[model samples]
Target: MSDFIPVNEPLLDGNEKKYLQECIDTGWISSEGPFVRQFEERFAGRVGRQQGVAVANGSGALDIAVHALRLGPGDEVILPAFTIISCAASVVRAGATPVLVDADPVTWNMSAEQVAARITERTKAIMVVHLYGLPVDVDPILELARKHDLRIIEDAAQMHGQACRGRSCGSFGDISTFSFYPNKHITTGEGGMVVCDDPDLAERCRGLRNLCFQAHKRFVHEELGWNYRMTNLQAALGLAQLERLDWFVARKRAMGRRYTELLGETAGIQTPLPRTGYAENIYWVYGVVLEDSVPFDAEEAMKRLAALGIGTRPFFWPMHQQPVFEKLGLFPAERYPVAERLARRGFYLPSGMALTEPDIEKVAKGVKEVLG
Candidate 1:
């Protein structure tokens, strides 16, 4: 029997150890180190932004970004219901309402049409998520933002190097965020970053990161904030990983293409597909959505795959359908068909950066055998 394949494993063959040693030698392993600054600058520039604020993790990045916007009660921020809960949680944390939109089955991102339909006078922003490394259709969303004078928080946590129409994913919004968790396009052990063009917004995020202290008086707090700072240890790892982002993205894309080629003819499931003119499927995790005709859902499929020594993960359950949100009376009558289907039937294969050709082939074979 072949070894069990994990859903993800990061590649850390670059300067990870060397930079970490340098940080240790300098005794600057905490957040206030040079590597943190270097990582922020390089990552922001790489993602086509003018400034970057490093944070403890991706969720912290979202919290600070939403805080920087100063949203409050009654503000409505449109976003995909098919995304990770953190995006919606950020808005709710700011005393705002998260207007949910369904995912586009092809792109697996919020449908722009749904966003427009949900817009109202109170709508202050649109949280554009580049889900599964597939950039959302931002052209119409940007146009909508412009018409309504609203902000866009581009959640590019899964889209380190992915782009739409030649523009980088993180560069499309007024404020953008990322996550450097182990399974992301890159890993910092655990860290995240915020990128933007506005100096004021950037400063606000920086202040929010460090307990909202005034620049002149470090300990004097004017507004409440959280200690969501990233340390030099994580920054060192991130800088090394960021240096190889292009190579990593290429490897991921190759993995996606290979998996699709191997499983394209399978009758029970559909592989993640890229839109011709919009974007290529970076296949962040090389997801598969089961056909309605299939006898079982993703849970049963994952069980069979696991029994074959293949590790798999289910897709994000839609926010609207979540029991927590339902308890809060937040989507009482709201129903998004596409998101509901994705929650029930979608899941990704083991498309980690460390996966070799043989590993992918074995995983594909396992998938075929289990689905058949």
Candidate 2:
């Protein structure tokens, strides 16, 4: 059997080890250190944001962003049903209700039109996720936000370099969050960042990540907060990962193109489309929709691939159907038809940074064999 190709892998070939060694030598391995500050500044600059606050993980970053927005009981934040549960969990954790909406089938992102229709007096924000590294149609979303005076928080965990109209994903939202898990476009082992242009919000994020104390004094705890700080070691790794972000994104794009080329003609499979006016998609994971005419369902295909040492994953389950959310009776299961269908039929192949051309061929061949 061939070596198993993963869905995604981090590329850390730069000064990661050297930076880590420096951190160890300087005894600044904890959350408070120069490396963390430097990493935040560099990442903020890269994302065209004025500030970046490092956190323990992407979920933590979301929690902090929601807190900064002051979204509490009686407030509702609109989000896509077909997204990682963290997007909804963060809102619930922040004491706000998550108003789930359907995703646009082409973009696999929250539908701006759907969001516009769902807004109400209780709606305080809209959380748009750039699912699978494809930038959500932010222009319309931003326009809607402006008209309604609603905050837009981008869940950019899977889209590190994705852009639209020359602006990066993180720059489009009032507060944007990124993940650095190993499977992401970049990795810091396990870390996240929250970026924003508002100085007060940024400062509040910094405080929220560190016990909500006034930064000047150590023993001051002015408000509620959590210890969601990232360590210097993680920042060292992040700096290294950031250095290779462009290279990683380029290789991922190349792989995505190759996949489309190889699979476009395959029967009963629909490749994702890159819309005009969108910036380069980083292809965090290469997703394909299995038409109803396909010989096998997504689960069966995934099982066969796993047996062949080729790992595959299904798309996110719609939040409305989740047991925890179902009990809340907030929305009916059949409301988001697109999201429900995607959850049942969509699956992504391995497009890891480490994947070679032959790996792509093998995956394509395997899928064809299974389907045929």
Candidate 3:
């Protein structure tokens, strides 16, 4: 197990220890501490947003964002069918219907055109995710939302430092969310943040993150909320991670390039290619999709890689095909062709910021050995 390269490993050789020590010394370990606000401000500033409200985790951030929007059962929120359940689950939890759209085969993000087609009078918001470090073609989404008078909530959990055209991924939306899970661009171990330009929505998210209690009276609650607050210790860790985010992003990009260089031409597999010009694919992980000629699906390929002491993860299963959705009768009649294919064919190699050149080489070599 020690010799096996895990799918991800957090790189924390920064001020993480120093700040954590400071928090311990000061006894500022709870959610209401200086480090929390500092982390919020710096992160919001980095993402080009006016405000950021820290939460417990990515799912909690999504929930708070949807809740802040005040969406309900009669309303709808459009998002990609290819993403994690958190995207749709947030909408479902807010008593809103989740409208699923197919993914773009090229970028693997949701198809903006498909999203445009799915919009109805009841549509209240469009949640756009910059999937796997590749920014969604969000200009058209912005235009579509503007024309329809709908809000855009950007999921930037996997897209730190990635841009769309000239703008930041999280800046195009009415509100945006980020995750600090260890595998993400930056990690706070388990944390998330909601960023936005509107002060009122910011306050709403803040209130929603904590129990929506009145500031005047701590025990007096005006609305329902969750205990989604991020502790000062988490914030201390986050601020440390944020300090070297640029370096982390650069290292990841390099690792991705290395994978593509090694595996781009591998038989029966389509490796992720880096794009230039504008906002390039940061290759959150160097994903590969097996062609039909391949003898194995993602599951089989992953097994083979595991035997080689390599780590890999399959692409997210399409939301439309999920058993939970099927049981709930959510997307029984819906289909997303690209997402469906990618689910079976695609998988990503070890791509954490901690990966070394040799680590990437080993992964690429193992992949070629498996699929060649």
Error of 2 at 97 (Å): 1.4
**Model 3 misplaced stretches (Cα beyond 4 Å):** 276-278
lDDT of each: 0.90, 0.88, 0.88
Q: What is the lDDT of residue 359 in candidate 1?
A: 87
- What would the C-alpha RMSD of candidate 1 be, to one decimal place? 1.2
Residue-level lDDT tens digits of model 1 in 1-372: 458888888888899999999999999999999999999999999989999999999999999999899887989999999989999999988999999889988778886788999999999999998888678888999999999999999899998888899888889879999999999888997889999999999999999999998879988788999999999999999999988989998898888888878999888898887554788777788899999989899999999998887888999999998888888889888888989999899988887899989888888999889877
lDDT ranking from best to worst?
1, 3, 2
Supply the global lDDT for candidate 1.
0.90
List TM-score per model, in order.
0.98, 0.96, 0.98
Candidate 1: stretches off by over 4 Å: none
The better-scoring model by TM-score among 1 and 2 is 1
